[model samples]
Target: MAKKKKKQKPKQGHPARLQQGVVSMDRVKVGRGLDALTGQFVQWYAEYRDDPELALMVLAAVRETLGVYAEVVGLNKVTDFDPPKLLAVLNSMIEFEETENPEAASNELGTMIYMAWVDYVEFLRDTNQWEREFESLDWFQKTLEAQDPFAGEDEVEADDELDAILDSEEASIAALAEITAMPISTMGRAVLSWVLAGGSSLWTSLPIDQFVETAAKAVENDLPAGLEETRKGLAVALVLQALEAVNAVTLNPQAAPERGVRSQDILEPEDADSFDVNFYFIQACLDMLLEQPGENDQAALEAWGLAALWIVEAADGNPQHAAAPRDEQWSSEVWKTAQVRMHELRVLGLLESGEAYSLPNIVRLAVTDVDDDIFEEDDELDDETLDAIFGPDDVDEPKRLKRETPYTGEVLQLKLTLKDSKPPIWRRVLVPMDLNLGDLHDIIQASFDWYDGHLHSFYENGFGGTTYGPAIAEMDYQKNEAETLVSSVLKKEKDRLDYVYDFGDNWEVRIDVEKILDADGGQLPRCTGGRRMAPMEDSGGIGGWEAKLEILNDPDDPEYEEVAEWCEDFGLDDGEEIDPAYFSKEEINANLDLEF
Candidate 1:
């Protein structure tokens, strides 16, 4: 949880400035002024927040006010008078005297910014263009990347294709219909062409990459919200949504598939000869399952169950996989619901009506787990449930292989995003999933200086629960090897994985815990599951410490732009004034490529 670390109150006689003229004053007088300024700013912003145009108007007015205030303070350049920047200057005045407590300084900063925004919107309302401001609401979206911290809104990127699409609405609308109606194989091309023509960039000012990520997230989030008919929009949306769904399931422990359908398609290259073909089917299955949740669970599961069997049977059922039948006695409400789905194919008569429906029986029938419980109780299983799965008659004796080859190839990519902080607050570490959490830990400890934090995030296919099986796993290793793990038991990585962010301010800190594990018996060194620092190749010195520190310290290096902006716009300066943080030439020397 984010603790709003408190501010230290000022002592008697401490003075706070208003960044206008000589702000030197007595403590009580300064506090009263700061409080009034903050209250007014907040009030202005609060009144017109719902109306974007009005909000912008008010914002402009506030900026003018600040600019005038700066002029009063003997500052000629008003361009540098951003709300955050203004507050920082005020804080600095108090700090120079050493009379303001950290907390008091912070509150002053917050209150001033609050006023600036309020004033800005009121200015907009006075200007009279409400529609544009209303549309600006789109700019506030999480993915929109309005670079200039002082810029009132995000700028849209112009893609030529989008221009054409927006220019010809009727034609574009017709094209969209075909895009959706067309088969998936040919859909990408249509989507490409349509998006090129759709002027989607005009929709918001976010950068293309973030726009895509944001669009993808939007589409994925809305997949279940209800599909709209935008040709290219839906196409890109599904693609990103699929990736997200895959990632989500890999991270979080969601309720079992609504239809109780389990996908055993391992994406590893060694076992994946026709992965593309099976992958296509998996995508289809997910779409059918996730988007059409209105259909009965059993009905959907049966259809997906058939699809799973179809893949297996296409190769004569030799995949060496087994799952409790949908009709099996698995003791999960989620699974039970999936068991009796009346297949969509059956309802639509598509199964028997078309040439595509004639796949062989081997591809149709899957082993429905009957009365036996093959999954272990790793997550929710009590002692009694554990005994049941491992009972003498429940599972057949295991066959030990004479040779167990360790995986040296990359099977899964571990990208840790410390959930608590902001984005790209991550590490992309590649390793054989088989490495233990302890080993991963040593590697992490060597790479970063998160000295006292513990715990890490772990998940596989979004399935987290006890009753370890193929979908769940853990971080610590089993004293000995005879165990099975499930993706469901891993920590919540659903939709987006969540990892332990126990580390303190430096962000390099991993919480005070040890290790992480994956679904396959593969292990990661017992390091906290968060974003990795620069890899060894990029780790110029001290096992990447110097490299991370360089990137960490000089954030404006094309690398730190986003984070740096977020810090300032949000007043995350290292207890300094915002002016030096955003506008001072020396502070942004890195941005100017200036030496010294």
Candidate 2:
């Protein structure tokens, strides 16, 4: 959760300058100054298509308004401000804010944003875009005497893909109802609010990521009348929806010949190897979230990543992974619903369709089970093919095994130096030969006494191996750090590696394998020696750290006390001066013993 900061006052002389353009008037006088500003805002909104920077300023201004009157504002935090909604709110605020009652501007903007959100939801419903949600409603209302006014509206035809999904979801709900003995009405109501929020379509689509950014804001702000429960339900419903999206292909039984009457030949790996389709699908979702093409959409990626993981766990038959304070049986019932929706995705055809999809890896790895009759090698292989497959009889004979070898404990002595340092803050450590890149991450953090508070990554110098880091970075690189071994990349002494900590600060560390040792029966992965304390957490890299050092050295500096207090928080001092050039080999080894 992001902590809300105190709103700083607007720049000096801002209101004074605005007063010249904003004519003195109340909400009653719309034709005067307010209308003029609305026109200007609308013009800027239109111009945003060409000038993104100008659009960003408008978003910042809206955020400023939200931040200033956060307590009174009813809209959720505007994470990714849609240009049109911002335009609408700007126009509405201009109408409501009187010259004398400037505070009214923030209130009006908040209300308008909330209204825009509601209208957007209504629009989705009106268009029958809420397919998942509509199905939920249809299930419970079947017995009602009051005829649905939207029945004709529902008949509005959907494409084959969408129709397949609607049919699958309906089937899933029915199956779960039977299996769990849970009433359709109860399940329907549980997810009713979710349907209104655009459901699964909203999530996998680009907009859901933007919407999630405002979730904290939604939690803080007051929802419209009778929507409190809807807001609350979103807190849980999103998880279910995200999982369903991640598992859309696997849960579809019709994709496989054995599971359904359709007898579709689902793709599978040709060899004995079986790829974890669920894992790759989740990775693809994470990749999409991390690449967030729109504005500040990092929040969306994180929310979706969490949901994907939960869904994958459920699909693997471990619903306990999402252990919230809910009925375990009900949650299992939901899992069954996802399972039965498998036919919704024709994964084999989709993979072969050559259509651009979010998960290319999933497409690449997807294969179909070979026909047993066609694959019978005895009948299919020609004399030449058999000869190629088995080689000459004498040459094909197996070689005898050599005697057992003794364990040769190998250690890599690495020299890590902070990049761009004057006096040169560095460390030397010896790690085991078989340690993976993921474990090495811990060693580097401990070597520098870093708390591992932020994102980090490793790049092998010269070699084109994938970059390894936090989940988002790994997803972006389409690689897993845990799967990469240290010895695989760094083979001998003088081999170089680059480690970067805290993407924001970009604290780069240059790592060189100083020596490859035979271990000499010594305990492995202990820091052998040298240099300074790590950079302060959240310090803006080398430049910021240097600036802080300057402030600490000068008692007369106005910011000295603040810097000192921050250092104190890190347990650097009681009254003693902070030491940048301090290293503890013993402490490093002790930590390594526990960590390794």
Candidate 3:
């Protein structure tokens, strides 16, 4: 269970003594502002107690206001808030809304942002932290009343033009030509010729070596005249590299080559073969390309390469060959959800227009640059300067394995024992030999009746070995849990691995391969044995859990009632009677059957 940090009240004359233009040399206090903001949320929620959804919306607005305030002021501590700071935060928010999604800016979103600041000021005053003597809200009202709401009409008009271009092929081409400083006719002719030469499939279907040679030959013989030789070489190189990346994903559909990207991390390779997974993989790659279009030449080629591939895979009149059925044993809800989302994309005209040989939507996206004003930093800052200003954003490369053998008709019966438990809590289950660590994590959650609310990882050798888990920002790991298979780590009987869940609570489970069995044509992942119920979430660690059990077992204890109430909140049992020895194999198997 994760522990919340205790909030500390502000000392007298802290920020009150600091004069204007003087940076406070105090050590940066973390979580103090967030605690105060949370208190403000409680106060706001009290008014809308009957409407929980409205209360949630208010909470979201408060969070957004806090984020924007942090970006504008470079600090989030509420002690830093003053009249001048409030005005700047509000003005920045309004200008940002007006620039991006102006329609939303004119609606309740703008009003919500304004009211959030008002609530914060009121909270400050109520807490006796409002150091300024002036009438802040009244002054803010008068200031806003004097401003022009339609100040950036010309900028808005330009934004509207970009939006229009995003929906039209000819407009997109013209915009691309303008941005690249290329002749419109030459750009148009090149795109037409590429589409004529089988569009995306020509690049995707051929072997890597053949595609590289083919692209190089096309640049020399078939590219439009008047294009610079250097530009042509760059284009071919970028497209070939992009094609190679997509092909790598097609080959290893389960691997998360790009961490922190949810679309790329969700699918398991066992869910389907390369052919069945190709369409979604290509879409994920295209999303990455658009989200982070590198330097100019690289960006243009990426847009062209990925956009063409997407058109071939998703557009009408160009269907991939039918794929064979994947292993029925590997069917899962995650794959089903991916399929549904894919259908939604097509229905919403995101991936396809239902027109034969449609032009790519991403071409316009590449040309129309939408600046993120809130998070924008100075472009003039060099890499070293930026690194000095902010901390270095470097991470170790994730570990990967080369699987040479395919899954045979084999299953592993494993015993998972919870570490440091008094009477012991454990589960024994059968899983396929080829199950990835990601799926194994899910099974562990099911076996233990955990809510799967926290991050988890599997260790190959031990704590010293490779770490496999989901991609989290700034955290280093050896491999992605979804991509590393069970067989790769535990090959034979008696092989062992350690699984840790809820990093805060640090519940470690020891997994030992008990037996290697042939397929008996029965559903795997069903729990065959176990002992005792798992500990409640957020119950601290093993020590905390033991303390709670002690309290619950004794009615006369001072903390008994409180501990009992907490247990009841988890739907465990009535305060009077608790069963730590409970084990329900049938219920566990039922959930596993549904999940896997």
Against the hidden reference, what TM-scores do the models get? 0.18, 0.38, 0.36
Candidate 1 segments exceeding 4 Å error: 1-331, 342-344, 350-542, 561-596
What is candidate 1's TM-score against the reference?
A: 0.18
RMSD of each: 29.2, 25.6, 23.0
Worst-scoring 10-residue span by lDDT in model 2 = 1-10
Highest TM-score against the true fold, candidate: 2
For model 3, how does the per-residue alpha-carbon lDDT over 283-321 read when each residue is reduced to its tens digit? Answer: 333344334323444223333333333333322123322
- Please give the range of 10 consecutive residues that has the lowest summed lDDT in model 3: 3-12
Q: Model 2 misses residue 96 by how many Å?
A: 24
Model 2 lDDT tens row, 176-223 = 232122121122222323333434243444344454444324332322
Q: Write the per-residue lDDT of candidate 1 for residues 322-396, one digit (tens) a residue.
A: 243443333354343332222332221112223222322211321111111122113443323332222211222
Positional deviation of residue 54's Cα in model 1 after best superposition, in angstroms:
71
lDDT of 1 at 44: 51
Show model 2 residue runs off by greater than 4 Å.
Answer: 1-408, 462-466, 470-475, 571-576
Summed over model 3, clashes come to 2
Estimate candidate 2's alpha-carbon lDDT, on a 0 to 1 scale: 0.44
The TM-score ranking, best first, is 2, 3, 1
